[model samples]
Target: MSSSPQTGSEPVTAPSTTSLTLAIIVSCELMLMLDGTITNVALPMIGDGLGFTPAGLSWVTNAFLLAFGGLLLLGGRAGDILGRRRVFLVGIGLFTAASLLAGLAQTPWQLVVARAAQGAGAALAGPSTLALLTTSFTGEHRTKALGVYSSVTASAMTLGLILGGVITTLASWRWVLLINVPIGVLVLLLAPRHVAESPRHGGRFDLAGALTSAIGVVAVVYALVRTADHGWADPTTLVTLVAGAALLAGFVLVERRAAQPIMPLRLLAERTRAVGFAIMLLVPMVTMSFQFLVIQFLQLVLDLSPLQAGLAFLPMAAGLLVTSRTANGLLGRFGTKPTAAAGLLLLTAAAAWSATISTATTYLGGILGPMLLIGLALGLVIVPINVAIMSTVDPQDAGAASGVLQTTMMTGAALGIAVLSAIYAATVGSTSAVLVGDDAVALGMRHGFVASTVIAALALAVTLAGYAVRERQSSHTK
Candidate 1:
């Protein structure tokens, strides 16, 4: 890892970055990822609080992602135009205030609105967190800083399940949302004193670029979700899908024309960046599909409780944490392509192994082994992909690059759940457990897991191409 750079700013020095500052950065990033999925576990309690229906429960999560994913490019632009530190503080303030409002919400809309507000804050600050670290350290030290940040983001979603389970179990569901207030306030206080303000890029706002990107993403996700209630052929669903695609295509054209695009076209055009984006998209696609399928296997087939269902994932989470620490050294020692390929290999193997699972199999022998491999391997893949995404980016466009990274991730999960869940439901022929026999449900889940394994293999193929092209290029350069 490289030491901190002397950028004529003493406060930006390595020594000035206290343990407190690191804690703040890590906490903030952790909360950002945590909020992305934490609400899933607390949905029952949230329903009780706000009187949500079974279908309405999903709105809590979708609301956040819609606003979060939609405005992410714009949020990154906001940080660039306004000031990273200033925008960060504003996001934290907004997030903390929204957390309070969400906790106190008496109606469904109030909670949904507050959650969307939180997502807006997340979109604003999430990009800047990485951008801030970019300016904070140089070379090797920068890599380590990024490694720490990357691990937290990768594992935070898993950690959220634990936090939400405990918080919702021990306290009221309101505590789930309220917990962010203290942590965010603490981070807000520590951020300014230690973190230096990056110089603002004085440029005109790319309004068309931002709207097209955000609207395009939301349209896609909303359409994907609509497939649950309306069949894939529904007119509303068709309109959303077409308009979303057209707007996204328009976004690409707008980026080429604009002087400063919300998404820099050149970044995506690079082979490495393109592969990284595809990895981001496909990894979540497979993982979310697996999650949807496996929960049914655990509860319907194996007869696990809601809490036990969540707990069944311990091996996956453990493997993820253990492997996240080792990824950096692997990437530092090996180039990005090899590292990513290994990760995709692990992921593919894990999912394919899961296809062997059946109703009579034991948890330890049947499930735990493959899940650990998936977690450990997934942990390894994230940093290499992040390295590739950030490496190709111009230093000036770091926030935009990071926003695009997140947008792909958010969109992928939504898409995965939609397509894979649809396949599962159609195959299973029943939505509710009481109506459908457990054996039939298990058969449907097996198909979904098998399909997910195939998706992972496709990702592996992409990584293999990455390996071949990158190595051939390296030899040519040498």
Candidate 2:
């Protein structure tokens, strides 16, 4: 196992060809990332249109999340054994068709099923984009390409809220899903010509590993989702949590024995890669919780319309795009550890600042600064961590690596929202005394931000500790 990350078995493509390929890959990623948050703004519209009970409405989001998060490992490995380009096309095509089905769905169940199909498609296609990008470029070109990818990734969720608000306001909520159709169609048609296929590894599919891991992930994510509605002590939550843990333990056993494991356990063996993955998990925990709580603050306390609330996130998106363009240079100059630490520091400050907001706090006075800081932090943080994790990955395990990285992120998001929402619920309590005004909601939201602050601080501590360990090892070698 060589540590050097070579531009895999892909042939050297022309610059024009590379640019087109990147465009296609980025387009696919944007669509997937957008879908993750786009429907959030339209949730009310969807619930009303489809006659969903308050409890049932959550499934629209959770269905897609469960499917995507659960199948990501299998999807990534499928690309390794099958073919990245073929898998990419098939995944995007399925996602596009599922989007259409969701848009046209007349019933709640129909839409939920379609959303799940979309997640399955995303799981298949998402890993290949990064795997392909890493394989297609090397040296400075790779860094710049990754910068672009990171920017798109970091900004897409915020952009999704903005676009969701726009589409839902002017047209209808259905357009939120339907919007992916043309983009997917374009990517599917152009991908084969531009996106070069990776050389597939020779191995039998790890069916047992796949089943255990996928089921385990789904069970865990379902448990997390349920925690938002039912407390952690609920019977369903406790049962699923234990079951998911057992299945995942079984998955580890299966992978260790399998000739061709879907998730190569060896990826987690390297300390740097492991640390990078941990940071990746923790960073999303803060971001997702921040977004979830802040959106509620914007609407419930501030009386902003959906469109206005979405527009408020523009500064964060702008900061992300600007900082991402420069993060490559920062990585080149300061190296990975310092750059990541700085980002996490910024994240801590932003979360701490956001924790001080009240019902009287205006958006410009309180929200804008933290939003901008958070955006910049994410760009700086995500790029370095990505580079650190993927830069030395063996091309043979690229898909699995990509899959694991994404799974960690999705799991982090799900876990963060559940935990923070639980904190909010606990603070608010069942008493009607606290329900008298928006002040209680504001206080609960403040507590959520405080928790986010603690999560960010913990991530920073871990990053610094990892840096110190690496430095000590380097001195010993000398």
Name the top TM-score candidate: 2
Q: On residues 130-242, what C-alpha lDDT tens digit does candidate 1 reach at each position? A: 88777666675666777788888878756766676667667767888999999888877777676667667777789999888888877886686567567789999999999
lDDT of 2 at 20: 81
| Residue 120, model 2: Cα distance from true site in angstroms | 0.7
- How well is each residue in 252-272 modelled by candidate 2, as lDDT tens digits? 999898888888889999877
RMSD of each: 4.5, 4.9
- TM agreement with the true structure for every prediction: 0.87, 0.89
